[model samples]
Target: MSRYSLIRSMFRPARTTPHRCRRDIIMPFPVGRMELIVYAAVVTGLIFAAYHTTLMDYLAYQRDYIAFTTAWPSKPADFKFDMNVFLEHKRNLMEYANLEKSLMQNGTALHELKVAKLYKPLFTDIPKILLDKWVPDIERFEGVEEFLNATNFNGTIAEEFFYLEAPFFQFEHHRMAIMFPTEIKGLLMTIKIGDCYFWSTCHHTELELRDGDMHVLDVLETEDGQWNISRVYYVPAHELLKVRF
Candidate 1:
């Protein structure tokens, strides 16, 4: 071929086969569709995993919150008093009380002051002598009989913790309350504040109180379902020992 003819031939476009072109190439399967389906499946799996993890965490937290808040079985009257549990709670109470006392004596920082203020009411120990008189089979403790005689008490204390199912005003409205059956049959003794906020979160619910609500402090004595509101003494958090009509 002449040089000019060879140059022209080199510049001419090559004839391509219809099926050989990149754009016209057909894969054996639907590659794009397969890729899309795989991507969607992966994304869905990730989303489900995230949702499941979050749901599990939430459920665990709810369980812990409920367990921490509920002091005993649903029915307080049916609860059998376990001395070991009571003593454990008592030790915890004493520890908190001591911590508060130490804070009061030595705490100077703002946080320390706040800590002392926050737990002061929750940590106060109920008088053991009063407990001896109120608690069933409390005479099992040494000196309970002598203390009872010394106080000149004649009325019989209730054998079990009386749970108040309905909300009532005891200083503040208590959605829940447990009373230590006082020797006086138809009298309301004192109701310790039972709010989770007032008692510093769920810590109070874990305590052992007698006449008290969630915390085992001295509370009122009532017939099966009747409350003698006339004699009820409600104590606020700030004024733990002070009597409010």
Candidate 2:
């Protein structure tokens, strides 16, 4: 070739190659049917595993919800109040009272009454100081034992004086209403009791019981899968208007 022609060829753009047809291309290792099947199975397994994990989490949340809502007795009928448990509770109270009498007679230190054994086991786990309110009394107890003892004493006194009073202390008439899962951190409940009286040579007189006092119970699930009340907030009947169920 001439020197001038070679220089012109170098300066000009090279001719572009024609595009190859799609059928002309070939993979180094073509995918076999078995390989495709394996790939599909792996993808399906991953999807199922993810779905199963999500489903398990949802089921767990539902279980926790159910446990929390049904933790307390809904009504008097729902409460498994065994007469044996009640009799044992009453006996404990009577013993504690007798012990108190003995302590007074012996001139012992009454400030610290060690009657922890008398407390009902069912309520001993409740905190001594609950939601800024002290259980049994405003005065602080020496320890958990003393606090529980005092709590049992006060509880028994309240039951005898208010609940199991003269003429009409029917267990059937006692009812409890609960409003659960409020926007706030606790549940609200009310206890209703019936009152009636008999008159001499006249018809029976029925007295309407006052509106029940509502209580807000702060419940917590323990590590061992048991539910417990951490605190109780007393909401007066009139204040129920402020609460959202």
The candidate maximizing lDDT is 1
Off by over 4 Å in 2: 12-48, 75-245
Per-residue lDDT over 100-136 for candidate 2, one digit per residue giving the tens place of the 0 to 100 score: 4465457433222222211223222222221122112
Pairs of colliding residues, candidate 2: none
Q: What global local distance difference test value does model 2 have?
A: 0.34
Give the lowest summed-lDDT range of ten residues in model 1: 225-234
lDDT scores in order: 0.36, 0.34
Alpha-carbon runs more than 4 Å astray in model 1: 1-31, 72-245
Candidate 1 lDDT, 1-245, residue by residue in tens: 99999999999999977664454365543357888698788889999999999999999999987865564223222223555555565455445445544654574553333333333344234332222222122211233233234333212231112321111212226333433333322211111223212122322323332234223332222232211111111122223322111
Q: Candidate 1: global Cα-lDDT?
A: 0.36
Q: At residue 175, what lDDT does model 2 achieve?
A: 39
Best by TM-score: 2
